[model samples]
Target: MNFDTNLILSIMPELARAFGVTMLTWVAGVIGAALLGFLVAVARRYGSRWLGYPLRLCVEVIRGTPFLIQLFLLYYGGPFIGLSLEPIPAGLLGLTVYGAAYFSEIFRAGFEAVPPGHVEAAECVGLNRRQIIQRILIPEMTMLVLPASVNMAIILLKETAVLSIITVPELTLVISAIGSQQYAFVESLFLLALFYWGLVELAGRLGRYMEARFSKYRFVTA
Candidate 1:
């Protein structure tokens, strides 16, 4: 069978709209997850056992469960308890919550990687708790975590496809719809892969740029 380049071009507009939705959700979800995960990591690191244990347990539970099930539970289960969420919001919330669990572990490890000597040195130099965390700990941890965080971003980007299961009309939903309607399953799937490939490539480049930017100071001082 011959591939129809024209058909692929013809669906670009629809796919573009769908891709926009996918990107928007990704941005919102990742931001929320990063913030929530950072908070959770900090709590686990600094809080007492009473607080830390529950946070750790929560992260473990979220990480252990399938993301699709979590999405379904949030969207479908919410209504039974009188919490009604619209499609996009529910999908974003699900992605954020799912991503947060993983990101928290990444952040926790990053925090742990900062040597106690560093914090002690900062304290010896009269840096307050906030000063030590802000000027010393966070910067070092960010550099260490950059690679893992980028990989997680790509994973989350692909996970956006699952949002289509609930009719969120993201890239995968649009591609599948066109494929089913036009009987061009192979072409549609190929385009889907292409889009994700482009996104992953772009994310990797951005991550590398950030890593370099963060490393510049260390290189200069050394």
Candidate 2:
């Protein structure tokens, strides 16, 4: 069978539109997850056991489940509970909740990586706990976490494919739809892979840039 370059070009507009949906959901996911995960991390660090234990449990549960099931549960289960959501919002929420679980762990790891000596030194300088965390630990931890956080973003972008199962009309959804129409499964799938390849490449480059700039502030002792 001959490959049709024209077919790929012909579907560019359609695919790009779908890709817009994918990128939008990705943006929603990253921002929502980062904020939510930040809260969860803070609670885990400073809240009472009652709050921290449940937050930990939530992280574990979300991490244990697949994103597809989470998407189905949100999209299909929302209507039954008297809350309705559009496909795009459902996709965004699902990816955000899913990403938040892992992000919490990633962030918590960064906090734990901060040395006890720094905290002690800050206290010796008359800084309170909040000051130690805010001024000393967080700034350095941000740099240490930058590389992992960037990698998480790449994973999140790729995982946007699962939203296709819920008919969210993302990149994979459009490719699948065109594949069904033209019976060009291989070609359509190839284009889909190319689209994802571009996203991941962009993410990787961003990660490298962040790592280079942020590494300057990383804590190191002689």
With a 3 Å backbone cut-off (N, CA, C), the pairs that clash in candidate 1 are: none
Off by over 4 Å in 1: 218-222
lDDT of 1 by residue, 1-222 (tens): 567789999998999999999999999999999999998998899888999999999999999999999988889999999978988999999999999999999999998888888888899999997788799878888888889999999899999999998889899999999999998988999999999999999999999998888886441212
Q: Model 2 — which ten-residue stretch has the worst lDDT?
A: 213-222
TM-score of each: 0.95, 0.95
lDDT (C-alpha, whole model) for all candidates? 0.91, 0.88
Q: Find the number of clashing residue pairs for candidate 1.
A: 0
Q: Across residues 80-127, which tens digit of lDDT does each residue of candidate 2 receive?
A: 998789888888889988998988898899888888788888999999
Model 2 residue pairs with clashes: none
